[model samples]
Target: MDANHLINTLFPQGAEIDFDGEFFTGTGQVGDKIVAVLGTQGGVYIGVELAHRMAGIVLDTVRNHPGRPILLLVDTKGQRPSRRDELLGINGYMAHLAKCLDLARRQGHRTIGLVWSQAVSGGFLASSLLADECYALPDAEVRVMNLPAMSRVTKIPLERLEALSLDNPVFAPGVENYRRMGAIRDFWQGDLAACLATALDSPTGPDRRRAHGLEREGRLMAYKVAERVRHDPV
Candidate 1:
């Protein structure tokens, strides 16, 4: 969906935002409350510039917004896979952005990530995956890497990975696969405004993706293994 249209649907009451075809920053109204909005669009690659800009927004929100909620609208292909970005330490910039969002959460600002479009690789990791609760639109595409790419990286045959993805949520891409893996809390359908509101009102908790993965049968042993590790005696 177009970013402007999505903003309107989410904040029917109106939002004070700025989008320059790639990055956006501003405040959005949600009933009696206001949320700090930061995001990317047009399937932009998350380069150092974009990562730094987003980190600044998060830090500013933490310092100025007090306890207001934050809404992250994600739509990125991934981090910029370029020699220029690599030379400039793009990973460090992405980490800074992630840290800023974590700071906001620790300071009592509710952080919610909504993947309105595509979210992949490091872009998703530094944004939506860092949120307290990450949700996605029904049509959103979320993935770390496609099967072919995974095959190249892991040296597994493309055919084998494709076959595994048929029954393994972790190896596939899509909102349903991610939901089954518990990376996505839920889908934002029906009423988007109400969905945002509910997310803001939702209580924050420790990461529950592993437990959700187990319950949904996407990853059967992750939760149990984590529990055993947590309780293991050194």
Candidate 2:
């Protein structure tokens, strides 16, 4: 989907915004406050430039908005897959963006991440994955990579990975699978504006994601392991 069309659907009263193929930052009258929505689209690869732009937006909002919630829309391929980016310390840039979002949450501004499109790899991690509340569109793709890539990475055959994904959703590649694994909060079955408003109005919850996954039987061991570590740290 074109980013402009997606933005229009999200912010019908949007009058000020900007998108330059890396990230989108703008003010839209979605709810009561002047909600600032920032996101990536068109398989954006998060490099140093893109990372700094996104981080700057979050930091600026936190400093200026005072009590407004910031909406995160992520649709990316991943961090730029280039030797130059790796050489320039892309990991540090990613961490910087994550820190800026974390600062927003700390400053009493509600943070909501909606995977309106694909939320892949480091692009998701450094942005929406850090949201106080995160969700996904029903048609959105939310995963690290597809089964074939997982197969290659793990040295397993694609057929074996495909078979495993059928039963073990942690290895699957859809919003449903990600929700079951406690990665995404829920599927946005409503219109984009309504969904954004609802999430913005909601309070941030404890990190019960692993618990949600365990109860749903999608992920069986993550919660227990984390609990044990909390009780007896190594």
Candidate 2 lDDT over residue span 31-52, tens digit each: 5678878877787778888898
| lDDT (tens digit, per residue) of candidate 1 on 73-144 | 979999999999999999999999999999998999899999999999899999989999999999999888
Specify the highest-lDDT model's number.
Answer: 1
Q: Assess each prediction's global lDDT (C-alpha) against the native.
A: 0.91, 0.83
Model 2 spans > 4 angstroms off: 232-234
For model 1, what is the error of residue 83's alpha carbon versus the real structure, in angstroms, after optimal superposition? Answer: 1.3
lDDT of 1: 0.91
Error of 2 at 101 (Å): 0.4
Instruction: Give all TM-scores, in the order shown.
Output: 0.95, 0.93
